[model samples]
Target: MSGLRQEIGQKAQAEGFSTPRFARLAHDLEQQARLRAFIAEGRHGDMAWMAETEERRGSPLSLWPEAKSAIVLAHSYGQEFDPLERLQDKQSGVIASYALNRDYHLLVKGKLKRLGQWLSHRAKTKVKVFLDTAPVMEKPLAQKAGLGWQGKHTNLVSRELGSWFFIGTIFTTAEIEPDAPEQDHCGSCRACLDICPTAAFPAPYQLDARRCISYLTIEHEGHIAPEFRVAMGNRIYGCDDCLAVCPWNKFAAAASDARLLARDALTSPPLSQLLELDDAAFRALFTASPVKRSGRNRFLRNVLIAAGNSGDTALVPKVTALLSDPSPLVRAMAVWALSRLTAKPEFAALRNDLMNSEADMDVRREWETA
Candidate 1:
């Protein structure tokens, strides 16, 4: 059985997972307190689920007493193509590297399930797999399992793989030996903190999700705050400035998974085409991809912000067409984009429409300076 555990690790390596480790299911009160403090401070933003299962997230044993061991896995998804290169084009929206290909949750979960099934067949014990879907604190579990240490950015960073890997876990009744916990290697490195465009990191090892571009553009819905929009640059979907600026990523490998590799359309998408995506078109464009979860209305809302920041008059017509969108959110952003594109004359021209328009107060505010 022990030899089989080693075989599993070898198999994981063969499958392109950078590192794999086993961790005993146990409580970590100190880590739990940190999570509580983060939630107490309202750092989670609209992600209510993070606070819902406090107990389960605090301890792996509490979630499943029968699970004696956790198999932690890390897969590198970074591409050889520099993610930061997209930022060079002021007119193109920068989608995060993780979302450039297929949804990672599905891809990693499928891999975990395959591994778990193999372990169950060999050990004749119950095995349950997770890929960032459960109440389990995956990063902490991975850290405790000796996969890597959580860096200043609060992401697990390994010496070899850097922080460009996705984590997966498998809980099993089999009593596999545990690995020693990894220690932090970030010695006086504030590169990640200094690189944030929105200052999302309030302190080292802590993230205020509300200010995070990834959170705002993807998880967040409705109107975006006035302050962060311009700073958002052309990152319409998710921001990678923090991830791209990390010095450790030089060691990160290009994705071995074909599904995780960057697709042609998303590699460096034109901002104009993104702004023109209607509901059906958006759905079809990102059908199986992670981007579809944001929906067309919110996505177009982001595009409007990007268009506004673009300072390119070429996107004016695309922004103008969305003013009459059924979704008030989209309409409001359209007004904001048009305002950013044109000056007082454009505002005066659209003054009567702005006055009579049923736009939100926030959107109307953009017109005040138009």
Candidate 2:
């Protein structure tokens, strides 16, 4: 069993995974309690899916009763440049490092499936694979597999790879020797917690997703509260302030996978050009990228918020053009952007003119409050 595990690890590394480890399928009592607490507090925001599948997500055994061992895999997608520095360019959007390239779900899952087939053939046993889309609690499973310990920011931080890797899992009926779990190494360090723009971390290991900029920009559905808008700055898709500040990144290496490398166009996309995207243009621009999942309206809504926080008068006309946008969500955010960019008197005049004609109640409310 130990020799087989060694062979699997070598194969996984060659397939582009950082390292792979085996973990016995057992109920993680501590993680289950933490997840229950998180759900009870409504910390997941609009992500009701977490509550819907809590039981299955709580343990690998519940997900697949036949599974006896989990092969946890990690793939490093470490940033080549400082993700935080892009925030200084207010005219451009600061997309998260992970989403700056092809969607990792597609990339990682392909590799995992191929590896699963090889493992099943070798052991003559059944196997199943999963990426982030699955209900599995991958972070906890990764910790149990000795991939890394969960950092103070509540993200997996590796001594070798920092917090800049994607995790995938393979569940199988074959028994394998489990690796020793990693222990917490974060000592007297609060860089990740202190640097959060929205203070999403309520405690050392607890996160309030409601106030998280990444949640607000990506998973969130409607109008972002006024308080978080300014703090959001130019991040249109996701925020990386907390992750980039982790000191352990000094030992990290740049992503070697060509498919995971950051695309130049998405690195620092111009807010002005993004504002002009209609549905067709938006779909074409983000095809195969995770940003497309947000849909045209929701993505544009984020762009409008970034434009509002930009304080650039040049974006006023671009924002004003969306006042009559087909989607109420886009129109509402456009109203907020216009109010921020235009002088009070000019904004009032424009609002008065547009208010009577606006049919969407939410969009009208934005103008009324402006």
> Which tens-of-lDDT digit does each residue in 91-208 have in candidate 1?
8888888888899988888788888888888889899988887888989989888988888888788877877888988999999888999888889998989989899999999999
TM-score of 2: 0.98
Shift of residue 39 alpha carbon in model 1, Å: 0.8
Q: Lowest summed-lDDT stretch of 10 residues in model 2?
A: 252-261
Best-matching candidate per TM-score: 2
lDDT of 2 by residue, 205-224 (tens): 99999999899989999888
Give candidate 2's whole-model lDDT. 0.91
Deviation in angstroms for 318 in model 1? Answer: 1.0
What value does the lDDT take at residue 160 in candidate 2?
Answer: 82
Q: Candidate 1: lDDT of 114?
A: 84
